[model samples]
Target chain A: MNLQVELEHHRRVLIVRLRGELDHHTAEAVRTKMDEAIQRGRAEHLVLSLEDLTFMDSSGLGVILGRYKVIKSLGGKMVVCHVNPSVHRLFELSGLFKILAIYENERTALSELEVVS
Target chain B: MSEKLEQISDHDGNFMTLQFASRSENEAFARVAVAAFVTQLDPTMDELTDLKTVVSEAVTNCIIHGYDNDPNGVVTITARIEEEIVTITIEDKGNGIEDLELAKQPLYTSKPELERSGMGFTIMENFMDEFEVVSNLGSGTHIRMKKRIESKKALYN
Candidate 1:
């Protein structure tokens, strides 16, 4: 279960790519990684690319919701992209889509969060 | 000698039992065990999805709530098929649920800090035809669920 997060910064926008299962065992690691990226990257916008994620439980929801809260407090926006069917159902049930913006793909999400510069 | 976890014949019903550690890895094993056991039946996609969801909920409850994250705890899963019905039982020796009714309530969780939705019982109930939870305060918890196998006649026509 490898969780890889890549940070692509375009001025104030940050795109994070996640791959792998996000469950109780791995949610903490994901939280830590994302937090580090936000602090070090100084990103004002965050886009989560979940195209390669295979599985996720409620624990995964916690991570996303937690990040949403963090970004909101920092006056930044959060977006999710490329959710598979299984994980998509979870997002729908949890009502995360209502709180966080969901894009069809990472490219679109990133474009939507285009920095002024 | 009767083993704690024994495979039973389908004459009474196609049933198999598995004993696993109360760890995250065991949840993966539970899913594989269910897939293998139900493969002979040739279930449809919907049926497979229901079975997987139910099994995942049961195993998760055993590990998170039943075992209280105790790695040394043990979880026993048994699956039996009688006629057109499939029955699965998951038992764990941990701090048993104090109130079965409250525990069954949707979105009710004892460990909210862990971000548990407390929808395990709700999901199990929705996926399975019948769901039952039996527990003692300090003894253990036993979750038994059943689903009727959809006949081909119902699927094709």
Candidate 2:
């Protein structure tokens, strides 16, 4: 349950790295952490790194969708990177990839976020 | 009949059971539950993937809707095996679903503000051979799901 976030205000980009399981038990914590970063950092671009996410359920999806709406409302962009194959399938089945951009690595996602900003 | 939680033995090499507090705990347990129950069966990678996805859906529903997010509510998960079938039952005594049919409809979530896709039942149905939701307004919900194990030969044939 380690969620690390770094904010680059010049580009209005926020990078979030999630570790451990992202099921119902941990979704709320992740959501709160992301929300705090978004609100306090005033970031217009969001990039999530989920390489260490061992598990994710629909609650994880809810957290992602909720944040997506938040960023979209501010006319910002959101991207996810380093998603494991299992979690990637959930995103695919949920059609989340159609709405949110995904990258192969965090640096790529951050670079892309900067381009958008 | 007694409003008591029971731990039934895993019978027919089909199922196993675990009880936990609240929806969040149940969701976490669901992952471990599936892994342990299916381990002895020596399932293929694809089968493991399918079971994990279905377990997530079923356990999430038991916690969110069945237990109404009550942190103190209890969820009982029973996984059973028959010949070539794997059946899982998740039961919770919380606020029961009002309309089973309406609840099963895709994208119909009582907690829309939470961004729930309301596709839990839909996903479960799609991944399993059979899915059933039985509930009473004030009692609780029982989600029973079954999936037929596809033989290795079936993949090539």
User: What TM value does the first chain of each candidate achieve?
Assistant: 0.91, 0.89
TM agreement with the true structure for every prediction: 0.83, 0.84
What is candidate 1's lDDT per residue for B39-65, written digit by digit as tens? 666677667666776777787887888
Instruction: Please give the distance, in angstroms, between residue A103's alpha carbon in candidate 1 and its true position after superposition.
Output: 1.8
In model 1, the runs with Cα more than 4 Å from the true position are A2-7, A115-117, B1-11, B149-157
Highest-scoring model, lDDT: 1
DockQ of each candidate's interface versus the true one?
0.33, 0.49
Instruction: Write model 2 residue lDDT over B1-157, tens digit each, in one string.
Output: 2323233442335445677787465565576677678665656766777788777777777777776677888878777777667788878887888877888886678888767877677778877788888888878888888877776336546
- Against the reference, the lDDT scores of all candidates come to 0.77, 0.75
| Candidate 1 docking classification | acceptable
Residue-level lDDT of model 1, residues A79-110, one tens digit each, is: 99997776676666657778888889977887
Provide the lDDT at B102 for model 2: 86
DockQ of 1: 0.33
- CAPRI grade of model 2: medium
